[model samples]
Target chain A: MLGPILETLIGGLLTGVLYSLVALGFVLIFKASGVFNFAQGVMVLFAALSVARLSEFFPMPIAIALAVVVMIALAYAIEFLVLRRLVNQEGIILFMATLGVTYFLEGFGQTVWGSDIYKIDLGMPKNPIFVLESVFPGGLLIDPSELIAALICAIMVVALAIFFQVTRVGRALRAVADDHQAAQSVGIPLNQIWLMVWAVAGIVALVAGMMWGAKLGVQFSLSLVALKALPVLILGGFTSIPGAIVGGLIIGAGEKLAEVVLGPVLIRMFDLAGGGIENWFAYVLALMFLLVRPQGLFGEKIIERV
Target chain B: MLYREAGQFKTSYSADQAIFSIAQDRWFVMIVLLLGFVGVPLVANQYLYTEVFIPVLILSIAAIGLNILTGYCGQVSLGTGGFMAVGAYAAYNLALRIPDMNFILVFALSGVVAMLVGVLFGLPSLRIKGFYLAVATLAAQFFLEWAFARVKWFTNYAPSGSVAVGKIELFGFAIDTPDRKYLFVLALVVVMALAAKNMVRGRLGRSWMAMRDMDIAAEIIGIRPLNAKLSAFAVSSFYIGVAGALWGFLRLGSWEPLAFDINRSFQVLFMIIIGGLGSILGSFLGAAFIILVPIFLNQLPHLLGIPLSTAAVSHIEFMVFGAMIVFFLIVEPNGFARLWAIAKEKLRLWPFPY
Candidate 1:
């Protein structure tokens, strides 16, 4: 029992880190645009599908490199073509546009790569790392790839933090996030800022896609997991990157623990006979969080002026 | 000119405040209802009734329910399918446990069960609003889907995790036939639609609209946010629950939890969005649009004598449908119901510029 618990915790941490990566992309876009891009998950699927197909057809390294470039281009194309035209639309309209984007990308990805799931081999060294046993506390083991994923996430988060805090364009992006009108008053080109932010978000999504694809294989179901990030965004506050990471960890660990511990108990209580709690565990946890703290763990308190 | 309402003059407050005050509008609605309930079953074939009419009617009922919440109350939900599943399963259990239970009573009771679930889930909306609220409701969707799928008793311990109704009857007339099923659905839809139309026009409806417009202001004006929001959830779920019963009992006849998946929720949501968010008439129009468009798209290629695989056709249909959503959002974000109102406004001022 203790062994499985520790193993689950380590696995949960790794999964949480990956979820944080996806959540970060959402935070960046929501912070910048105030539009919750429902398509973020689809973008992950699209990126993974692109990488999987490219690697299949071309040299692995070159395909990975080209896939990154394609994602960046796609990001720029979306910004230029669709989002550019929708600059001043209502928030709901923007949300709907993203839904449209979700559909388009899903159909487009399936069309390009076919709907079959593909095994993605990124040529990472698949050796288990001997980490401190004390950390996990009971012969809990983690794969080297997951540690690498966590490291990558840490680096990405730190890089994003620095980019936002130290860079001029980052400051401009911050300005836009604060107030679109005020940002314009400061002579920040709103359209350019939006395009740049969207591109950055795309990059974040690409990394998330690669990491998740490595774990789950490149498939449409990956997009569904991306939907799980919405609750993370809610819990972490839409505008807070650190909040996203923390929220992801809590949700990830919480879901796994619930499944392993309380799931069977509830199943027995309800006389459900067969235990399967992990399926809705995450959502139920999110819902509980929503009821208690609508602003989320790190979200700013919403003040309505009307 | 045939649609003119020149002599329609309201003399009493009841007449003035009537659902269809305009004589022509009333006549037109009555005719449509008659055609739907009585006429369609007579003239339409089995395929039209089974594949088209019953499905459309059931979806319209669900759309009307969603419209009450999202359209009028301004509480966006992503759990209509979940609530529908609750209703479907509840009805299934009610029918199975009480072998001699009335099918209609079971259907109505299933709606109450859904209402309870909707209210339980709706508790989050009290603190959450807008997109946050939508996410909260999505939790309901996934949770309900999982519960139904995993819980063996919910499916009556079915081996394949699917549920089916035994048979349905109303007063010893077997509703097994397609035309009979269509009539049953059409009758329920008409009754529910009328109830919805009336409800939305009353005090409760006004309160809901006020809350949707501005919750703070509505609160200031003494409308209890808890009451308005929860009632919206309750009533909306009640309607959606009944529709789910019909959908399972009449339309699909057998289904897994996937039948009420998130995709179905989005389909109903898109119907309300594209039809008219706050209009009862829009629900039907939206449901018709959503239901028929794919069918029409699928048939068009075949009708044109083009040879294409169903998969390819479905792909094109998705692309076209997705593009149409963006188009409608851009063209008239208020929805197809607004378009109808605009046309009516124009018709009221025919042959005159100003």
Candidate 2:
């Protein structure tokens, strides 16, 4: 009993790392642009697809490098086309524009990289590892790829934290996030900062894509990883990176545990096949949080002005 | 000169307050109605009725529902599909449970059930605003999608989780033929569209607009945010629900939970955005544009003698819509309705060098 429960906990926490990475992209863009970039999910799929396809001819490192260059170009192009043109537009309009971007990317990604599923051949060892065998009769089983992903996420988070703390652009980013017009007054170019943030977000998406693709084959469903991140963003607050990490962990654990514990109970009570209760556990939890605390765990209190 | 509205004056307040105060505008609407009700059905084939008009009309009602909440009330919701699902499943259950129920009555009750669900989900709007509220609506979307998919009772225990509607009849007239279904859907759409028009022009509508413009100011002026927001949600859900029922009954006749997914919600939202958020006619314009554009896109390569796969055409469609949306926002955020209105304004002052 203890072994299975511990394994599930570890499994959930590891899955949460991938979610944190995705949510990090969301927070970065939302902080800089005030636009909830709905296309972030599709961008993940696009990045994964590009890398996977490019790997067919080029080596893995070369494929990843080329994908990075592509992502940077995409970031710049988005800044030039949609973001630059729609300055001072309503947030809702910007959000709608991202939906358009999502559609474009969906088709564009499928068109460029074949629509059929592609295996992201990371070539990671897939054999199960035994831990605490002596302590428990049956040891906890762990997937090597998931453990690697969690480690990469930890290192990335640390690197990002350091970059933000000790860099010039990072200070500029903080200034802009605090107040856009004031940052402009202080000689921080808003457009450049936006471009920088988007580029950083693109990198974040690429990292998230690689890991998720390795776990679930590079396909359209990979885009839906964004759906998992949304509840995280709502719970963690869109501006706080640490909030995202914590939110992801909670949501991941909650959903996984609910699937194990509550799913069967509800299934039996309803006298039906197993309810895919995992699909909505995080969202329902987030909804309850919204009702009680609209600002989220770390979001600043919103002051309405007329 | 063709579109001129000069010398047409309103004689009274009621005349001034009429939907189309301009003689030209009124005449245009009347002619369009005649064309829709009479001209189209006379010449249109089964493909046009079954494939084009029926789905377009049903979806327009759904779009108008979304416009009320998102456009007029300034409350962005991404749960349009979920509310529609509520309507579809409610109608499904109603029709199955009460075999002898009136078709019109079944649709109405479905709308009511959807309205109640909308209000339940809408409780978050009083506390949150903007994107938070948008995300909140998504909870409704996913939960409802899960409910419809997971619960066999919603689909009447169909092993495939797909439900099919029985024959629908109104006053002993079987709604069997494609044209008949088209006419029925059009009539319902027309009534609801008019009703939506009327609702938007009344006190509640004004209150919604006021709240949209500035919620705090609207509240200061004694406009209750809770009342206006919830009503917008309820009414929007009612129309969407009716559309969902119609979609299931008239359009597909059989569909699974996938019919009303997040994609469908986004589609209707895009319709309102591309059409013109605050305009009544914009809903239809948006819906028609969305439904017809892909068909046109599919036919374009064939006409040009270019060999493009269906997937390539769809990709082009996505790129075009993305570019078009950004282009429209940059050119005019008021969308295609305002573009139409602007053309009319230009025509009114044509042959003038300004």
Candidate 3:
């Protein structure tokens, strides 16, 4: 019993880390542009699909490097062609434009890759580090892949924190986030800042995409992971990085725990075939969080002007 | 000269307050309604009624529901599809379980059920507003979709997770034919559209507009936020629910949960945005524009004597549709309703150098 619980916890933590990575991309864009990019999940799908196709011919490492370069170029193109044109639009218009981007990317990705699921060979070293013995007689076992993913996520978070706090460009990015007009008054080129932020967001999306694809195999369904991040954003607040990370863990673990504890009872009560609450648990939890604190765990309270 | 209203005069306040005070406008509307009710049934073919008119009418009704909430109430929603699903499933159950129940009664009762659900989901609006509320409504979308998909009760434990309705009848007259179905939907559309127009022109509508423009100012003027918000939800859901019932029973005749997916929500929302938020006329225009444009695009190649694959047509359809949305937003951010108003203003001063 203890072993299974521990294993579930580990699995939940790894999945939560990936969600946090996606959430980071969302926050980066929202903070800088004040527009929620509904297409962020599609960006992940595009990156994963691009990498999978590229790796069909090139060696693994070379394919990955090429994919990175392509993603960066794609980032620049999106900024130059789309976001730049949408500058000074209302937040809702910008949001809808990203929705258009979502549709365009989905169709374009499917047309290019042909709607078939592709296996992603990231070539990461996959081995169990150790087996854990439960305090109970029958012990649970944990996988090293889950631990590795979590560790990688932690390192990435630290690096991002350090970059934002220490680097000059990061300072400029923060300035732009703080107040776009004030940052402009300080001679920061707003368009350049937007391009930089989008690039950074695209890179984070690539990392998230690769990690998630390595787990689930590259497919359109991977975009549903964005649904998980929606609740995470609501729980952690839209603008808080730390909130996103913590919120992801809470939601991921909460879903798993609900499945373990209440899945059977509810299944019997509802006379359902599937006895797991994993699908609806996260949404229900997030709805409760919204009711309790709409600002979320770490979001700033909004002040409406008359 | 026949279209001109030069001799029309309002002698009383009630006459001036009539829905169509101008003689020309009144006569034009009567003619259109007459053509819809009496003319279309006689001349329209089955394919036109089933494939084009029925679907467009149902969608226009749904668009009107969304326009009430998102346009007049100023609350952006992404759960229109979910609420529609609730109405549909509820109507399905009501029509099926109650052996002697009339189909029209089922439709009306299903709308009431949808209203309850709408108010339940709308409770979040008391605390959240704007984009936050939009995100909150997504929970409703996913939850309802999951419920319909996973819960066998919704499908009445059918072998497949799909529901179907038998032929509908009213007053011992079978409504199985396309002409009869078209007339049925047309009648509902006229009744509901008039009801919506009247509702929006009333005091309740003013409160909603006030809240939409500025909630704080509305509160300062003594309008309770809770009342204004929840009533908007109820009324909006009521219309959407009826539309859903009609969509299921009259139009599709059979459907899976996929009929009311998130994409449906976005489509209805886009209709409201493009059609003009607060106007009933805008809903019809928006729905017609969205529904007809795709059909026209699909048929264009055939009309032009070019053979194109359906896949290619669909792809081009998507691209052109997306581009058109951006173009319309750029050109007239207020939507087609605003354009209609502008035209009306011009008509009020025609043939003169003001």
Candidate 4:
């Protein structure tokens, strides 16, 4: 009993860290542009595809570097082509535009990188390591790649925190997130701020893409998985970075643990055909949270100005 | 002079309440319907009826359903595919088990099933709004897709987890051939389109518009947000569900759970985006555009005699389609319906400045 529970918890936490990485990208773009950025998932897939294609002939680091450059160029292109024309449109309209971007990126990514699945050789060891032998007797098994993901996620969070606190551009991003007109009034270039945020979001997406690609192989489904982080965004609060991390961890652990424990028990108990509740468990959790607290765990209270 | 309603006097409410008060507009619809029902069926080959007209008409019905929620009621739902799946599977189950069931009744019941699911998913809307609500609907989308895929009962214990509907019969007539199926779907779509038009033009529609414009303010004006929102969801879902039934039964003939995936939801959404939101005419226009553009793009290379790989052609089509979506949004965010209205407005005063 103890062994199973410990295994589920550790496994959940590691996957949760990756969810946090994806959710962080969502939070960044949502805060900066207030658009919800439906294309974030596609961006991740696009980045992963770029990295996978580049890494075919080049070293991993160089491929990653080129991927980052690709992402930056994408950021600028999006801002110039889509966002510039859509300035001052309704939030939903902008959101729809991002949906358009999603279609464009999906097509672009598949065409450029080829739609066939490619395994990302990140050189990260994926062997299982057993620990807590004294408590569980049989011990709990954990993957090395998951541990690396968790560690890298922690470092990324810290670096982002410092960048927000110590950097001038970060300050400007916050300002723009706060109030677009006010940010522009204070000598911060609005377009440049948007470009910077998108570039950062692109980088975050690249990280998430690499992590998820390494786990699931570089394929079409990667985009869909990134979208699964949406409920995490809503749970953590779209505007709050810390909220995203916490929400990601919570959703990650919640779904994984539930899938491991509750799924089979419920299936057997109720005579269900099979147990696949992981798809909706996190969503239901988020829906429940939204009902009780419409603001989310860390989202600001919505005050409608008449 | 060709399209003017200047001299049309309405001495009674019924005259004023005519669907097309304008003489030319009334004539136009009649001509179109005449062409669809009689002339087209006589001349159109199997390919046009099956490949283009049937699919377009069915999809338009679904687009209209979505327009009610997203365009009219101001609720953005991403679970349209799931709702449609509910309709499809329900119809499938009813048709499979109830050997004596009426085909029309099966379609109606399918709509009801989808409506119930829509309302269930729509429960989140009472608390959440905007993008949050959209994500909640997404939960419904993923969950339903999972349900149909994993649950054996929905698929009637099929080894492959896919269920196909057999030939549908209405009264004494069999709708087996493409032209017959096209006519059947067309009749259903036309009736539903009329129903939708009247619904939007009536009291219930005003309430929906009020709720959409501003829920709190609408509540202040004595409209129950619950009633308004749920009814919109109910009606919208019913249309989509029936459309799904037709799509499965008539168009695809057989479909798996993957048929109504997230991409289907997005496709319908795009139809509304490009066609025109908040307009029934736009729903048809949007569906037509979405269906035709790809077909046209696919045929373009062949027309040019370019020997490109099928995969490469599809990729180029995607690129073009994506670029067009952005271009359309940038050029006219209000969509083709609005553009049509602009053209008509311009035509009323043609050969004159202002």
Task: Give the CAPRI rating of model 4.
Answer: medium
* Chain B TM-score of every predicted model: 0.97, 0.96, 0.96, 0.98
Q: List DockQ for all candidates.
A: 0.57, 0.71, 0.41, 0.64
lDDT of 1: 0.86
TM-score of chain A of 4: 0.98
The order by descending TM-score is 4, 2, 1, 3
How much is the lDDT of residue A213 in candidate 1? 91
Tens digit of lDDT per residue, candidate 4, span A1-306? 868887888888889899889889889988988978988898999999999999998999999999999999999999999999998877777887888888788878888889999988899997898888887788889899989989999999999989988899889888898999999998999899899989999999999999999999999889987667999988988889999999998998899888988898877775567888998899988989999988789998898742
Instruction: Give per-residue CA lDDT, model 2, range B1-354, as digits (tens).
Output: 776666887789999899888887788888999999999988999988887898889999999999999889999999999999999999999999998999899999999999999999999999988888888899999999998988778888899989998888899999999989988988898899999999999999999999899999999999999999999999999999999989988998999989999989999998998899988889999999888977777788899999988778888888777777777777877788999888878887787735
Per-residue error for A34 in candidate 2, Å, reads: 0.8
C-alpha TM-score for every candidate: 0.96, 0.97, 0.94, 0.97
Compare candidates 1 and 2 on DockQ and give the better one.
Answer: 2
The superposed Cα distance between candidate 4 and the true structure at residue A253, in angstroms, equals 1.0
Q: Which stretches in model 2 have alpha-carbon errors above 4 Å?
A: B2-6
Model 1, residue B295: what's the lDDT? 89
Each model's backbone clash number: 0, 0, 1, 0
> Given candidate 1, what's the lDDT at residue B288?
92
